[model samples]
Target: MNKFNMTAIAVAVGLIFSAGMMAQTMSKDDYQAAEATIADKYKADKANCDSQSGKQQDICIAAAKSNKNVAKAELEARHEPSAKHDYDVVVAKAEADYAVASATCQNKSGNDQDVCMKEAKAVETRIKADAEAELKVLNANKTAGKEYTETGMKEKAEMTEARQEAATDKLEANYAVAKEKCDALKDDEKDSCQDAAKMKYGK
Candidate 1:
């Protein structure tokens, strides 16, 4: 196979493995075994291609090497931290802002307290949304940086998808929290909380 086809095959295999094994953590021995298996397969593929003659042989060899490189890089990337620190920082800031906002609502009374809480929640939601967006961008940039050498367009597209997935995950988490908070309130307080959630998240 040519370099492009070989690369595609390797990517397909990697993706299949990635999809089949959804476990986030693997034992050291298992990880090492998996890596060795991949390396051996790559070597064998390269050796097979080496027997061919002329331009075909050269293309096959290049393809095998490219595939091996891509696989190795992908394995490394799975272990690499992708914007985890950045996301943590964003979450921390959002939590701090939310705390401050919640506290500000504590001293007021009746409608004033309700209004204050609503305003506070609005600000908190905005901060969280902004943070989530920033984190998504950071993650995309990280992925792009990692894959730029191999395939720029493919990496960019994957990173964009990853960001969207992350955003959806965050939104679901935030929505659950909002729902719980709304559930905790009673009567008009509940109404106020729902209103605040709607105003912040959308109707």
Candidate 2:
């Protein structure tokens, strides 16, 4: 791939994985339609390559196949969201790129061809490594999010318990004051006052 195309693919891969976390499964009809569309498109693309010859034909065929494979992987990832599917998309992209690059390398001769093939392999390895790293980072973020939510819940429960204790303490203090006041009242009135305080404080 050229610099511009590689950059575009990188950006796309990032967005795809980001969205993959929340992607819902596609409807059966939609999935089937997409599959049919991909098949038709691949056939048309391959037919276009038939006019070419030698290395040109190889390159054209490689490009057609790569595009098809990548599209199919992307479709699967969208239809069934999972870490495996997302990783598969990345793997498909790497393989597709390597296929194109290898085809291109065949146009060269001698040491030049060897060097080209090696370079293509290196690029494929790098892309695969990058994909693996991205997957690891995504998983780490997911784990961190879950831990944060659990911590928040625990803190909220503690706060609620604290509030209840504070309310109980206030009621007990008020009841003590009410009972002291009742002590100054005479016999029957004092008993009635204490009863009222007890009921009011839920003692």
Candidate 3:
């Protein structure tokens, strides 16, 4: 299946596992014991799968592991207050950074301003990329299939490329506007302005 489809499947698996785990209420010790058992199972499965030399075996092993990790994370989120707090903190920081970058970009002028905005967007993109990577790692740890992991990586790469292209287009448009503004200035000042714009926005 395609990367998008595989990611969807992995997410679905995670949701299902989480729901199943939540259906059972257990004491703290019981939960810990259960988690240990799951971890052992995961290790055993990984070893067995590794011993096999086939594509299907590898995929199966990966999927099983991914599902397990997802379940484990959900369990922790449900039982551990700290995990939830940490997750929230990371999300909040990312949002805050994005806002700061966007505001900074807005205060810039012409091509320079546009470049600044694009830089802000790049920061946002980086944040998103980091989140995605973390999710992917979690999924991988859970033993998500190789196909799913590979697909997620490919999708992320494509998204990054698309964002870059869009940012470049915006930069070009802003540079044109900057050039026009520069043209209205006197000779030396206009040349200097254009040079500054070019330096900020590129050729």
- Give the winner by TM-score: 2
What shift in Å separates residue 177 of candidate 1 from its native position after superposition? Answer: 17
TM-score of each: 0.34, 0.64, 0.32
Which residue pairs collide, candidate 1?
none
- Compare the candidates by lDDT and give the number of the best one: 2
Stretches > 4 Å off in candidate 3: 1-88, 144-203
Scored by lDDT, model 2 comes in at 0.74
Arrange candidates, best lDDT first: 2, 1, 3
Clash list (residue pairs), candidate 2: none
Error of 3 at 34 (Å): 32
Cα lDDT of all candidates, in order?
0.55, 0.74, 0.54
lDDT of 3 by residue, 132-169 (tens): 44444444444534455776666656556655654665
**Full-model lDDT, candidate 3:** 0.54
